[model samples]
Target: MTSFSANLGFLWADRSLPAAIRAARANGFDAVECHWPYETPVLDVKAALEETGFKMLGLNTRRGDVSKGENGLAALPEREDEARAAIDEAIDYANRTDTAAIHVMAGKASGPKAQATFLKNLDYAVTRTSRTILIEPLNRHDAPGYFLKNTTQARDIITKLAAPNLKLMFDCYHVARNEGDVLFRLQDLLPIVGHIQIASVPDRRAPDHGELHYPTVFSKIADLGWKKPIGAEYKPVSATEEGLDWMNSHLC
Candidate 1:
């Protein structure tokens, strides 16, 4: 059977992080991940995970100044110091929370300088911790000007780095939007994939409502021997619990 991880970033946006973790556990999710938990006390988040007995799969580095249109710092040539600071902060938080991975956000950047900056930051990140370090390719539609835009670019970075801990964060929704062949990409990149996420294409809502058929996708995932819990990173149309029939239907 395939396992699912609730992404608290979208699923329970109104609740506290600790409460969201507990909610995910109560809702039958196998694990939980978050976007940013820096504001929450690490010990509080840790206690919730301990109490619920659910693994915290991953979390992302702080997107610098959302108001300023800064999505990430690592790829910006001028913000190298802030980028490393964000990486260090994520590592510390992950260590304290017993999280399994960190998705390093590349923000809005382009050109060789941006790629060089990203590679430098990634090297710094991988050497600091043994935990998996992931880089995701956000779709141009959702994240216009985002540095990493496709799996090929992400895969090439992983291969060039050659760091066992550095891996791709294969977000199916983004992949479908950017490149239509989701299953083929998943198969080709499985070896370097650290985590997988899903949502409805274009709408970014619950996976069950999407253009992609998750049952087929999930079956393909199982066939490919991906044993980890897939991340459900979609925004709910109503109460998160109400939209979870998709999970039940898939599991059955």
Candidate 2:
């Protein structure tokens, strides 16, 4: 039915994980996702999830050395050990928090070396955990030099790896910006897709202001038989709650 998941990463940066879960539940979100939850104790986040009955959709592995502009370690080649360690840490965190998936960032790597590293790390990741492991394609405009930059690349990697646990994190906003064939691409990629996220293209704001019509897209998702939560991964133009009228009417 295209249930909505609040992306606490963008939706409620001002609050703690527990508080954000409460806010998401109050706002009628069926589930919740986050970027990083390592700062907060897992018990508190788990307690909030239990209290709200909201699913913890997924979380990301830590972006290596944010100070040095390293986005992730998975594709760095030189950081293979660190990347595997990060994967193990993420699996532990997901298990502790009851998160269903883990989006392993590919960092700022490019070319064959990067691809090789990513493939090796992904192979290691799927072997270590039963939970879904996701690869998202960030738009070049928003994330220059990022290792993975398109759905096709992610799809190819997933295909080459042949890991049942590895899947795509299809962010509609990034796809639209990079490829622009949203509906058709969704049709092509839905089979291997594990999670879907949305935001206004160009502006990265709430979906209501986007070039894409989310209501239509949501309907299409339902028609395609997608049974997972559609992630609300957008920066609100104003207060996050103020921009949710569209979600309230459509998902809630």
Candidate 3:
């Protein structure tokens, strides 16, 4: 299997950012995926990484001030300005972290006008980054109105955007939740998927918690020549390290 990335955001949403980062490194993970590391200063993170030798595999664009009613770009009609700013922030963060990929975390889908604005905003962001921006789908159960909720819709959006600097972030949990044909759809979407993420279905626990066989899935990905890093984006049922016990046993 390829080197897996520890996602501090989902794994330790309740814990302090530095605590989560250190825990991932101590637990033997080689790299991390920072979702919004906005709460923790990058300087401290850099210092911790220098001490621990952990690398940042990727990062996501920070969403706008939600307290100000800017939930996301995909659903906001007049937030193109905020969306452009968010993309610039993500690019700067990626440059600092020395990573090439950035996940454009898609927000809710309000109406037709919102979609039009979302695509326009995405086009603007796409032009800013030489590296492709990843668009991820969140499950409907967790996000009732989230845009790009499945591979089919993500596929359509990416096709319509038609930007060389645009791709997909295929998360196994969301894929399993919305569409259970993980292997088949993976074959079809791999060309567009820049990064992959995994968690147990429904519960978002460690991969071994439920029936989604990550071994076969990962093996298939390996077979398909997907050489990029995959993020372990799961919510631990217990302590984060405790949940990753299966990784030491199953993932080599």
Best by TM-score: 1
Clashes in model 3: which pairs? none
The local lDDT score (0 to 100) that residue 220 gets in candidate 2 is: 87
**Regions of candidate 3 where Cα sits further than 4 Å from its true position:** 13-15, 65-71
Per-residue lDDT for 64-148 in model 1, tens only? Answer: 9999998999999989999999999999999999899999999999999999999999999999999999999999998999999
Of the candidates shown, which would achieve the greatest lDDT relative to the real structure? 1
Off by over 4 Å in 2: none
lDDT of 2 by residue, 36-149 (tens): 899999999999999999889999998999998888889998899899989999999999988999999999988899999999999999999999999999898988999998
Q: On residues 9-77, what C-alpha lDDT tens digit does candidate 3 reach at each position? A: 887667776677788888878777777876677787777776777777677776666675444564467
TM match of model 3 to true structure: 0.90
Work out how many backbone clashes candidate 3 has.
0
On the 0 to 100 scale, the lDDT of residue 165 in model 2 is 92
Determine which window of 10 residues in candidate 1 has minimal summed lDDT: 243-252
**Ranking according to TM-score, highest score first:** 1, 2, 3
lDDT of 1 at 22: 94
Q: What lDDT is obtained when candidate 2 is compared to the true structure?
A: 0.91
State every prediction's TM-score relative to the real structure: 0.98, 0.97, 0.90
lDDT of 1: 0.94
